[model samples]
Target chain A: MISNKQILLLTSLLIFSAASILFSLLSGSVDITLAEIAGSILSAETNLNSQVLHQIRIPRIQAAFVTGGLLALSGAIMQVLLRNPLADPYILGISGGAAVGALSAILLGASGFWLSNAAFAGALFSIFLVFGIANKFGDWSVTRLLLTGVVVSAGWGAVINILLTTSSTNNVQSMLFWLMGDLSQSRVNLAHYLLLIAGLAGGLLLSRSLNVFIRGELLAVSLGVNVQALRLLLFFSASVFTATAVTIAGSVGFVGLIVPHMLRLLGARDHRFLIPSCILLGGSFLVLADSLARTIVAPQQLPVGVVTAVIGVPAFILILRSTIRK
Target chain B: MATLHIQSLTLEVAKKTLCRDLNLQIQQNESWCLLGRNGAGKTTLLHSLIKQRVIDEGSVLLDGTDIADLKQRELARKIGILFQQGIEALPATVFETVMLGRHPHLQSLLLDNEKDIEIAEQALAVFELDSLKARPVDTLSGGELQRLALALLLAQAPEIFLLDEPSNHLDVAFQIKLLTVLTDKVREASASLIMATHDINLASRFCDNIILLLEGGEALVGKCSDVLTEENLSKAYGCPIQSVHSGEHRLFYPA
Candidate 1:
């Protein structure tokens, strides 16, 4: 099952991710020379270059990569759980609900970490709403569950629209930009990194269960997996992941929807390989995309979400074409 | 001892009564056929044994153990079923798909043992799926998938087999081939089989016992020869039925 082609792709993806991290630390409004970068790494820091490298760029790059990996892995889990190719980490309205919560908190004069907490709460709320609605009478048919998610997501979208319309005009521009997804002020804290790492490991550990669960509930049950319990566990874990991603960088859309799918195209069918590959590829994809967003126009920044779709679409098409050929 | 015993079972589906006060026992080494027309409660009755649909009025015992008392894993190891339409777009290969039958017996959560692989390989070869072993289940045809499913069930190595419309999409040649293989397997293991199929010739060819389920929960259950008569089939199907002898075999058809 471990083809050399897969090994090569995996190795290349890992190298690309590492390289992206290094380049992200280097390329920004304040460009540190290669010598300065090396000197900072070699020695201690009294210089502003090292300060920017460690405090600003390092954590920002880490946060961006973690968010990307979390979203992509979560999206992959959701796709199999819902059995819909279009299912994403935010398909259950987690991001939409997060947006509403974050926006409302901002409207109420909450800033900084509180806004992210509120967004996380909103994601939890959405997860509970969807779970409750679908678990009614124990009917967890894929179509019903999918329809419920879409409808709830639409409801959250309407609430977001209303919040935008009702908010004071002064806060409107900033909120709109945040809604479009900006990570410039995102908290690149230690806890966020730990959570992402733990989530990735947990996903790998559960990948075998996912392999059975993905096929269908009946088969999962037949295989002695408690399908209902596994479903709840996957749904909530993915919700938490989407919450983390949205809390970090607003809604970086296509990384979640596209990275795992692209990995699948490269013959990473088993979840054991698929989940970890998603971690590596997703981290590289968004880090590179965010780097482009920061340096595309220099000094003036676009939201990374915008850059993500633009980069993801054509890359996905090429991958799709290659996969179809195979 | 009976492999499966259903006691006074009452089942209802979508406001229609599928069975009521139904009692049956399937002994080890026996192959039983559920002979009935569409909606004759063949599927509903069979599913109750696996705890898919809970019966309100009675209990199904597996080796004198109440099915409700057994956990999912133990029950799965004891009784395996092939549904009418299994997962078609499963991402696993035929080998992997068949290997999944080892799940109930797997001691670890992540990996399968070589014995599990050996058993799966044997089942795949017997079911004629060895050539498609590496192909993903999604890429398989209906007949191929059917054979793969049967191989998977066989790999499970359950004591009781419940096959619902097991030959729905199979060609005649494959149907005979698969059943002939299965017959030999069950005899060797002294396991029991309960198959719900529309093909009467298949029942006459393999089954030792047959149940003719009539409307209103009236059932005629006995030896295959005694219960699968034209009068009972016509009454159950609500149509004219005639029995014919083709040399050494018996076949039933609509008149």
Candidate 2:
């Protein structure tokens, strides 16, 4: 049954998300006044402020929010799928594959659309590679999948290092920006929003089975959950989410690894609540972090990934310590 | 009421035969205990009965339906199993853990209804875990965890119960009390139970039938009194066993 406390927490998160998005819209290299924002909304004027708001800030915010939601949602599912609390979206080498693809495209003089396509293709390739190898005998255990993913990720890491060393200096800066997850050039299409919504809905639908699964696989099977089917579904869904997020923002870290843990530590362990909450909280957290990244230096931007790590590590440590003290 | 039938069941692990051509017929309201030493295949047999493991040969049927043909959810509504280990992975409140037993009965994308909540609550009360329902499962002691596991099975309310070492981590007094409550509940519902345990005395006291798995993949199954001879137990355990008459009950002890 849904509890009133969960409802209250979710409502608070929803409000917080809206407020963070508003703050992100308002804060940037060139500060747009509240009056100007209201004017831009109320009157469809093609002024400079309106142009910046519509063309630059709004798309970047949407990109950040959706990417954050996807990453956090994927992290939550990965934790359950691998039955490890430390599991993150990137643990299965999805981002590694995406990075390799994106970097290869960059080397070949591809940008934007083609870069994303390359990243997605590489992610899919890595996904199938891991799935194929781990499930070679048709009965892949969790440890096997984890080992294969980690080993494949290491392989990708080597490839990524090689690419970094071989690329021209002019291209390296942009490549680093993509790898560190820059929102300056990030944009969201309709498909990104759809994938985020689909991921959230799918997570909710499987929330009950996930709840049963965390206890143990044998217990899940005995309780009527088709463990094999559930594992397959989780693997693909989480992989797809990670892939999409990577293609959008090029591997934002910490949001995926910490947002879900923060929620769990706050007592949102129930997947029914955790899934949606991850979307709201993770999205807002990134929107706020990106805002800080944009205005922290003003005119010169910091990568959103750096900002997320800088903020996430200490906040998580504090939460962990307090939880332990309790 | 549901019956479990195992015909010519053969189970193996790592190319070693755990059991061969084992036939069993468990009728309604019957409680059977699997008594075997370590690696004698008690857990393997229970797993095979529930179709959790692939059998080398033969079939397991529930109410005349082959379990292999039934869906996991269908089988779950008719049969429940309490594993040997307690919850060690997830962090959840005791109440939430117990409520997971209702998972099989829930419709897709729907919440647990009031009836399901009531059943879970009643199971918590039965296990004397009402005070700890709000407490996190990871914080509970081993005995409390074991009791919670049993409570979850009660919430499942299946027609057949399969328990592996249900007495593990249970204190002496609570063990007797919980086992008594469990057996009484099974009898009241006219459901059958199959338990795998290492305690010969406990099995002798609680079960109506005995399945003693010996070395060489051979098994002796019959009424408790008929198959629980000193020789059979000694052979099954590969040890010298002695029995003592405790008024109306016969208890086994190693010599």
Candidate 3:
């Protein structure tokens, strides 16, 4: 049973997330009022303000929330899977691999959906490569897995540099935009939201097993968990989540590394509560960050990753200090 | 009736031979101690018996069936193990951590039910961990952590127990206290124990059988008195050991 304190904290985060979404909808470079946004939703009108709200802000905000949520959840799983605090969704090189696939597709004259699909394929390929190397001796050790992923990520980094170097200047600009993470370019697709929700539910379902896993391999196996299978599932799940988020917003960093630790500080270490809480906190955090990104510079629009990294670093340090003090 | 039979088992770890052509049978109600020096492969051999480590040759039969054929969950239900060391920290309270012992018995992945809670609380009360129940595992001292791990193993209540130095970090009184619980389990004849340890006195006092594991995968296996001879103990330990007998009690000390 969840404690009263946990319920209170979760409910508060929900309110904050909802407030951020509303804030994102109402406040942007385009001065869309709350009334206009609400009227557009209620009446399905197509005026200028309503058009901006429905056509751009809504999808962008929703997608930002989802991508952020996905990254944070994936990071939490990675930390547990490898039993390393420094682990993040990108540590296994899924994002690096996705970036390679995406940049290569752009180089090959692929645009829009095709590029994203190629990115996912690349992420899947990295997942298989890491697993193959880690499971070579039939022992999927966390240390070995971590080492394999880090090396693969480095390999992907070299490939990405090669692609960037050889590509034309025209493609370089778009490639850089993708590399820095841009949620504004993502279409308002229901599939992304649906996939995010499904993955979160699956992760929460696996939370108890995760709790045992985070404790260590010996305890997990002694408790009858199939550690190898669970490890594989966690790796793939995190990779898939990373693939989707990277496809949507290039590679939003810091959110994955920061948000889950913040939630842990908030006493949401249990995976059942932790995964769901990450969705709320991470989604709200990104929505707020994206709003600041577009408005803080007034129409120039900094990359969402830059905004997240800027805000997330300070917030994480503060939380870390508070946790240490406690 | 529950028996663990090792048939011509060969095991190796890190290019070191742990056991070669090893055959042994341990039945319910028999308490055995695996005595060995460091790197003697006691840990590796115990792991091999539980099928946690891959065997070079032969099979371990649980009751009448090969352990390889048994499902993981089924094996967990039949066997419980305690590691020498625990996670440096866990986010759970002692109550929550110990309650995890109900994991294998749990009908599903949900947290403890009424019965599991009852078992956990009973174990806590028996082990006298009430004061520390609400504390996080990291706050526990060495002895406390060992007791907590032991309590978790007891609450699991499997048919077989394979403990790797379960007494490490435990205070002398608590050591005897926990060992008495294992002795009681032996009396009930519902579970068997195979404990690896360096304490020959404790083994001589409690074990029905003793196995002295020497270097290079050779083991002197027999009853406590038979295998506790000065010659075998000295040879296995690579040290001169003399057995001093006082009344019915036997103690071996360095000569």
Off by over 4 Å in 1: A1-6, A33-35, A137-140, A166-170, B90-92, B107-112
lDDT of model 2, residue A127? 98
Model-by-model lDDT, in order?
Answer: 0.83, 0.91, 0.84
Question: Model 2: which docking level applies?
Answer: medium
True contacts kept of each: 0.35, 0.80, 0.37
TM-score of each: 0.94, 0.97, 0.94
Ranking by lDDT: 2, 3, 1
Candidate 2 residues B1-255, lDDT tens each? 899888998888888887889998999999999999899899988887667898889899898999999999999999999888756634688999999899888654757788888999999999999999888887898999999999999999999999999999998899899999999999999999999999888899999898899887889989998999899999999999999998989989999
Writing each residue's lDDT as its tens digit, candidate 3 over B128-230 gives 8888988989888888888888888777778888889877987888888888986786567578988899898888888889878888888888898778889
Standalone chain B TM-score for every prediction: 0.96, 0.98, 0.95
- DockQ scores for all predicted structures: 0.45, 0.74, 0.48
RMSD of each: 2.3, 1.4, 2.3
Candidate 2: count the clashes: 0
Interface root-mean-square deviation, each candidate: 2.4, 1.4, 2.1
> Which of 2 and 3 is ahead in DockQ?
2
lDDT measured at residue A78 in model 2 versus the true structure, 0 to 100: 92
lDDT (tens digit, per residue) of candidate 2 on A270-305:
889999999998899899999999999987899999
**Local accuracy of candidate 1 as per-residue lDDT tens digits, B111-136:** 55678888999999998789988897
Q: Write the per-residue lDDT of candidate 1 for residues A173-276, one digit (tens) a residue.
A: 76776776777787577777787788878887787777777777777776667776777788888888888889888877788899988988887877878888
lDDT of 2 at A28: 86
